[model samples]
Target: MNEAIKSVKLADMPDYELVKSGTGGCAGCPSPMGLRIVGKALGPNSIMVMTPSCAVASIGVMPKSCYDVPVLNVCFASAGASAAGVSMSLDAQLKSGELTGEKPTVFTWVGDGGTYDIGFQGISAAAERNDDFIHFCYNNEAYSNTGVQRSGATPKYATTTTTPAGKSAQKKNVPLLMLEQRVAYVATASLAYPQDFYRKVMKAKSIKGFKYIELHAPCGPGWKFASSDTVTLGRLAVKSGAWLLWEGEHGKLTLNTPTKPLAEGKMPLTELEDYLKAQGRFSHVMKSPQKDAVIDEMKAEIRREMDFMLGREKL
Candidate 1:
């Protein structure tokens, strides 16, 4: 219920650690703690245009980098056309003044097989040309760095390595498909709410155009779990209404951080059957015998997607 909800305080972010402590992800990989808190809220000016999964195979490779800024790898369906050509060639080298200071915030650290399948038409044509930058997507769902397979943000009965037994279509709510493309900003976030993912990456870097978020990175070995339960299974998937922190901006909807105590019911979902019995990709839908009708159809599709994101938070 975002009646203008902006509250971040891990002592108000920005002490810049631009993701560098031994970053090659895997042991409890929440994508290297969601790329070290989104590269410390996009500081060190910021470039990060990645692709080919797991944010460029777990933070930089050769010459042993782990990002202090300037990442740029590209191509898994061209991460929204290489972050819209690095935000229009750094806005034409700062309007022909030949690139000065400030204004280096281009983004795109895709994965979920490059944002819900082959870089979803280059971030839906860079959100129909509103493309200035910021397009995150960490989404540890599937095709996790090219081995776990089954991705269109894989969900439904879980399991993967090309849906070994589950994933019968259901999980692509790419921030309500980027708020149905009216995109000025859209959000979901979840490395289990580190200050609501640092106040939504400092409010999507104080917005511009085509900004998207979609965080939720929790694939400790592709959901087999217990790499210290990846931030307690991303806080039991937002206290078990199954990941629905919200935000839409420009096109309206709100409901941020823990989704307003799970939309005013005061967080009563009590972690979905012990968070789907602690992962193992839903442990073959919890050892099916039609495991209580597939956990009551995943608790009625998490109460019909938390009542379709609290009925789009009124406007």
Candidate 2:
């Protein structure tokens, strides 16, 4: 893992004052908090391209918007394209001297449904072109906005409305896909590490060309967990080595946060059972007759993932 310089104190960062509190997000919905953190990191000159996602349903609704920064709501598949257009238009204005002062940073905020499935084409095209913008995917592991349906981001053994028997497929490795695009920056962040998340957002803002960050956003209602357990689940996920935190800059990968220690074997892996039992979505996984097999499968996957991150083998 490449070393990362220590980040600045949170108080020293800019206050964009964009995302407001008391939004329509459900209790423990991490979307609003994630948006707020990104907004503050980007400061005042920022334009967000939104899509048909839980975040949009919560904060980008018509007649009343909770964001202080400009948000353009597009179709589910158009977030990347829309943001690219905005970035080009802003660049044109800046070049023509029509837009003075600092130029607005273009960003697209979407959920896993929009990112891993519906909007993948547009996003892939934008990444290939090295578009000047940031793409943030707040993944809660399902189509959380539309009744907790299964999505490409859904983890194996997690039951959703469409996958009540537990999903047979593995979750999409989105960050690795972005890295394959050879973009300027790619990272994974968890709300449990607020400062780490904030630091990545700030780092992305400073870079040029395409940037992608996937945030591990825990959904309270969708996952059937206590609202207060949102942060706890996030922490456990990292400690358990189920979710790895890392950053890729200019094609170089560096493990970050709790993942670094786990991958390096400096820290013992937290019990996967502890993390799985805490979420109601995985209740079936624990009670199923094949529970032992399912648990072993999950454990194998984690080991393979950790080995890949530590450069022992490809995942």
Top TM-score model: 2
lDDT of 1 by residue, 1-315 (tens): 233547667677667787777677778887667767876777788888887766567665688777788777867888898888888888898999899878978887777778888879889888889888888888888887767888777888888877788888888787887787768888888887777777777777877878888888888788887788888888888887777787777678777655677757875767587988888888877787888888888888888777777776765
Q: Evaluate model 2: give its TM-score.
A: 0.95
Worst ten in a row by lDDT for model 2: 1-10
Error of 2 at 6 (Å): 3.2
RMSD of each candidate relative to the true structure: 16.1, 2.1
For residue 217, what is the lDDT in candidate 2?
90
Each candidate: what lDDT? 0.79, 0.87
